[model samples]
Target chain A: MYDHKTRILYVEDSLADINLFKEFIDDKVELTVVSDGQSAKSYLHRLKQTKSHFPNLIILDINLPEISGFELLNLIKKEQRLKFIPTVMFSSSDNQRDIKDAFSQAANGYVVKPGDLGDYSRAIETFMNYWVYTCKLPQEQ
Target chain B: MLSKVSTFKTVLENLSDGISIIDKEGKHVWINKAMATITGFTKEELLKSSPPHIYWPEEELDTIMKALGETMEGKFRNFELIFVRKSGVRFPVLVNPSPIENDEGEVQYFVATVKDLTEVRRVQHELDDLAYNYRVLHDNTSELICRHELDGRYKSVSPSSIRITGYRPDELIGRDPYEFIKEDHLEQVRQNLHEQALAGNDLIRTQYEAKRKDGTIIWLDTITKTLLDENQKPTELVTISREITELKSLQTKLEENNRELKRSNMELENFAYIASHDLKEPLRTIDNYVQLFEMRYSHVLDDKARQYFEFIKSSAKHSIQLTEDLLNYSRLNSSEFPYKEVDMNEVLENVCSQLQSRIAKSQAKLVYDKNMPSLVGSHILLSRLFINLIANSIKFKSEEKPLIRIAVKETINAWQFSVSDNGVGIPKKSRKEVFEIFRRLRTTDDEKGSGMGLTICKRIVEKHQGEIWIEANEPKGSTFKFTISKHLKESTNV
Candidate 1:
């Protein structure tokens, strides 16, 4: 009865993350991946240019090349066309101030990237389950 | 007393109030004309009316007359009567009866002075309204105004305090004020109040955080003025408390907002400084390129092209200098400087030594009165300030060899210094503009300046809680006077 074919975009640079996300998702959603900030920007731009259906959710990494996640996040949140895309920040460290700032700025969620594969698998599973069923996936514009 | 005196009888009957006469037999032998009019009877009709038979309950006439007899026997008394008129209408009458006697001194008649009770009733009604008004006044005021017992119990409270504390008058009456304070803070509150009382000081007001019955805390700002007992000893504390929890919260929010604004301003200032710092490298590169173009290609280009190259170089350099000065100005407000006593003579010497090249170029006459007073300030900042002012006087030189004179004197709690120059005199209107950062009122031809020297002097003076101002020098020049207060110490708080 649940929407299992949800399009979830993991805007992260780590290859290990792609593997860990696959392990937890187990064909639950059509997982998409982008390696760097420019690629993420290009992927979103392509979706808009071709009038393709956008991803229902996005998980953004804070540390990125070319365009930092802070700037990209600001850009996305400011755009009425893209603001409805659910965003979860995938950070490498647990910074309370960063969490507070993110929350105060209305971030949908925050997830710390785990170090080892076991921790990564568990973290991926938690995030997958949280977004898959815990939140209502957005409809395309 | 004589039976033949009918004129005397007529005089008594014409009185406005009720009047009556009784013969020795205690019979209602005669009633006055006015009395018959008030009783709804003619004098002819009242003459036939008997004493006990004429009045209802019949006992009232007899009992009052009996009391009147005692009054007539030298024990005077006064009383009112609601007597029935002959028409069966009830009315009010005041009777005052005096004894009339025969020539032999035996009792004969009783005469009295009477007044109607209508006005008395009206006055009583007005008194009732006044009492009601006071009752509302006592209930309506929200001043927390209350009388207290000598032992510090709330004797009474206006309804206002009930709304403030969510407590009924009965609940607060016997309770000590300390009970409302939080348990951990109760002793401190008690001790402060006790100390104030023992010192014979009225606790005019105090503020503290109080706990409510629901366990929520509120900041209580109270004013307690003492009252003297009948023996003239301090007895009670009349407290007026306004629940300042909301006000205190608002104050906290306002303070936080102020801090936020201050931080944002600092960040913006730092941004400006960083931008200026980054621009300097490019500006230097631009200046170097312009000079290279002039040196390598001046023979190939027209005079106009060479002149254009010079203007470009100059404008770029000026902008770069303005940014640097602006960075310094903002940094002054953003950074705190430590204080030390600085020797003005040393400062002037250093400034003069730095401007040696500029002084030599002008072949300028520089006069330094080395016996200047010592000032308390930031040594490095003060030296820079002096250097800037002295250089400006040289830079703005008119046609003649510039004459610059520096002098110092001690004033109340401060030292004032004047650096007068016989250079280009600044106009009065343009003086204010000169003290604004990077503002130049005159053409850049006569002098090339960052236009921030005077502003930097202003900043330095302000940092020391001192002042710097411009004045017209005699004949044709400008004078820069600056004062440094001796109390130029660093603030204890950041």
Candidate 2:
């Protein structure tokens, strides 16, 4: 199982989610934030140039400004270190067509970002509880 | 007296009809068996009839005598009256009298002949009943038979005209024919009619619009003929016309609705073209970016990661091909592709020459015979149609050798051409399904396909009013058979 203080990379566009996620998850795990795909891609490239910052998990959004979330997912899925990181699709659209498309692209899991704070809290809690506590993850030291 | 009595008896027996003789004093002087039978009386009872009592009133007899007195001077006289038989049967009679005078100039005797009129009267009654029934039938059905002089005056019109046009026959008697036509279209109607008539042609079964008394227009489907006078020169127009405006209006509306539906379909096809084209831009960027990463860091990607990258690269390339096929399919439905006669033999040769390398590498023998009849259709689309079929035949072939044979034959309406290949054949039940998008018969394990080629072929064939179907080639192959008609205009003329 992954450690309680495993460093994680979370790429998100919403500031409120950033604030809420940091407040909820900072005590459970170390969270490194990237505001948009540009920062996320740049950070990833920088890591590739030196020692790889292999995070335990990566949460992705499908809709991004410069590059689409799908393109980033495809890129990460193609990488040796990142392909096994248990990436989850976190998007605002609950469209069934988009969901089917995500699964067809072999995504690990898809999570719809609800506006309700309670639902968001439950969803985030469930995702973390399964991945961090119950299920096993690579804990290479 | 005895001799004269015998002579009178002989005269009465020889007459064809019932006859009686009465003297000047109006007493029945003689009677015959024919007269007794006709009057339904015995001969013994009919002789010695009272003056003017049998056939006429006493007063009418006096008037007859007065008229006959003038005719006695030199004229032949005729008289008619009704007589009752002994059985009370009544019949009309005519009497012709010839006066015979003595030397003293006194009117001594007048010989009168009486003829029964029942037979003639029976015939006349039958004729009158037939004429009455004919008139009633014309009135009920709104059929008017009109006879007009060449000068366009009404010679005769049945009472039926009133019910049809709300105009009495008398009112139409002197009216001009052109006056009945709506004023706006009157000139055109007149020009058409005058030209036909002057060319010695009778306008038969023509349709025109006429204004009623209230200015409401109605269509008249009329049939007319020429009426010739004694000189045999055409002098009149006799026409039969019925109304059909309501039927014509309904047909016009139906056609208009069909036109609107067709326009909407065309707009949808245009949207398909635009969406397919726009989706390509982003796809190109991903492909280019992925290529850059591979070129820059070939050594860094581990075997496991490299395998994942290979899948992604293949997916992008496959997507681009699918997009092109979709674009081509939608482009066909976007605009009206004007067509002309295209020679199939020439088209097949050009396409084969283009795909020569694909044919050589696959060891495929593409055989297309020459002298195929010309088909009337769009060359560009037809060329696309042949290229897709030929490529598929070449692409999917038996491992040893790929052989394709192209042959053509003329059928009832169109020319049938078959492109047979030694490639894998589609199953019988799945033949129709092969024409749908992404409906690959075999799994993509061996060969990849978009499954749009047959669908495109079906669409193009239908547009030309033709058909396409699949049949099995000998051994192990599928033969694609399609037909396009001989030049449509030329076929219609023949």
Candidate 3:
């Protein structure tokens, strides 16, 4: 049953947003959460060693503790093995500079958190439909 | 020739020069009428004197005898000497002597002619004094005065060259002035001179950087003029230069400070934008949670609980609007917006349609001319400006259907626009205070506004390099008047 599901790794610092994302996903995918850039980097490093435990998708928050999402994204894009996995920037910031910066750092996509619950739910649902159903990803191994 | 002896004697008597004949024994044998006048003596006294006569100054008697002995030997020449008159006054004279020969060719006596030289000596002394004064002025002045040949070679340089260029006059003369000019300015200087020559400009002023003899750079302010010959043809160029290095450096420092101030101001605007952006996240969370609470527990909630939720939701929404308005206000000062030609009529139409529901609900009518102008400004900003004005007119209506008139007038250097409204007018005392940021006449509970609309409009006008203010209408309303500079270009920035 788990083998057929998509795996997602979320790196975020806000507790409210983390809880919201957990509720929105609702076991539709195999999700793992890390609260800071350092732990997320450690988890990715371990996944690189295991080779078969890599997630199909990664979601990064631009503002984080310890290390910034932009610095972590730069490190991930530079690694040959991790560069294959698609990374998306999910943040409440709708600033054009942040969006442009995300793309310039080789992020696969950018999503702005909506202001209301209904809009946020719809936006996440659409995002899941696109990434899990429509777009294809590299093999886990 | 023998019969004309008397005529020769008559010519000698009338001559301007004094003439005398002396014997070998130093006795005066004959004298002309000029000689008697020149010696200040009668013929009898002059003829009676022998050697050391009164006509010769006593200080030069020995030299006079030596010269007389030389002249008696038939070796005649002109000599300068001082002669004393009988009145004891001494004067300079030029004496020319020749021997008088007999028929047998033996020297018998000497004939001498004397010319007065007092006027020539006096004029020579005046010329020498003038030259001394000119030399004193040229060497002592602080300005670097120089004369250059037509080809730019230094013909003469003042002593001040040492102070201005760190070079002595000897080192600079005969060298091309271009050699001392900085390489970056060489071509420009050459072009300037070439153009002046072609136009026959008598005087031109220019400034440029130059390298001194010690390789230190300095700025020179120079004025050059062509020295013309008698035929009005260009002969040489006279240039006067002064060192302006201190002034140039001060100007450079001022420019640098201006750039630094602009950078810091941009940073402040960016800070405001980012702070407002961060503030929105928490507001969104509060709004979403309140809505989620209502969706889950509405059935069990009473009137009081529902009222509290509504208050929380509305407050969150209001705060969200405030942050968004602040963000847009900051964006107006940034360089992201493009300045281009925009039609005011189109901008007004866009603003009207955006506020169509509000306008209809309030039964407000907008009267505007269709012949609006195209101006250089940001289209989005101008539309926002109009929307805020029209919306305020509708919002503050005074128990009557609102009538807003948008008009434009052409001035010499700008287009003045007026937005008049038949509504509660602003008091004269509060007109200036309304433009201040976050300053509102009405309380927040009475008016549903972020209090940033007028502030944003003021910023937009300022960005266009124009002014905006309020004027009381003739009877019972307020008119908002603003101007747009007709000469604004596409590159203008906030």
lDDT of each: 0.73, 0.72, 0.85
Instruction: Evaluate candidate 2 and give its CAPRI docking class based on DockQ.
Output: incorrect
DockQ (Cα-based) per candidate? 0.01, 0.01, 0.49
For candidate 3, what is the DockQ-based docking class?
medium
Off by over 4 Å in 3: A1-13, A18-91, A97-112, A116-141, B1-187, B193-198, B201-205, B210-218, B223-246, B293-318, B409-416, B428-433, B443-448, B483-494
Pairs clashing within candidate 1: B96-B112
lDDT by residue (B1-494, candidate 2, tens digit) is: 57996787787676756666555555666666777777776777666556445534344667665655554564657777666777666678787776667798876656666788888889999998898887787566576677776765678777777867778888898777678877777766556564455345676466778888877888777767776668767777777777778866876888898898788877777676666666554555455546655766767999999999989988877786676567667777744355767777777777878888888877888887777767787776777778888887876676758888888888888888888999877789988888876676664454676778778888888777788888988888899998887645422321
lDDT ranking, best first:
3, 1, 2
**Candidate 1 lDDT over residue span B131-209, tens digit each:** 8887777677555566566555688776776666677777788777667777776666566654465345775466688
Worst 10 residues of 2 chain A by lDDT: A112-121
Q: Residue B275 in model 2: shift from native, Å?
A: 1.7
The better candidate by lDDT, 2 or 3, is 3
- Model 1, residue B422: C-alpha shift (Å): 7.6
For residues A34-86, write the lDDT of model 2, one tens digit per residue: 87888888888787788866666778877667877777778787877667677
- Over 4 Å off in model 1, which ranges? A1-141, B1-159, B182-188, B203-205, B211-217, B226-234, B333-336, B352-375, B389-434, B466-494
Query: What lDDT score goes with residue B464 in model 3?
Result: 83
Residue B197 C-alpha lDDT in model 1: 55
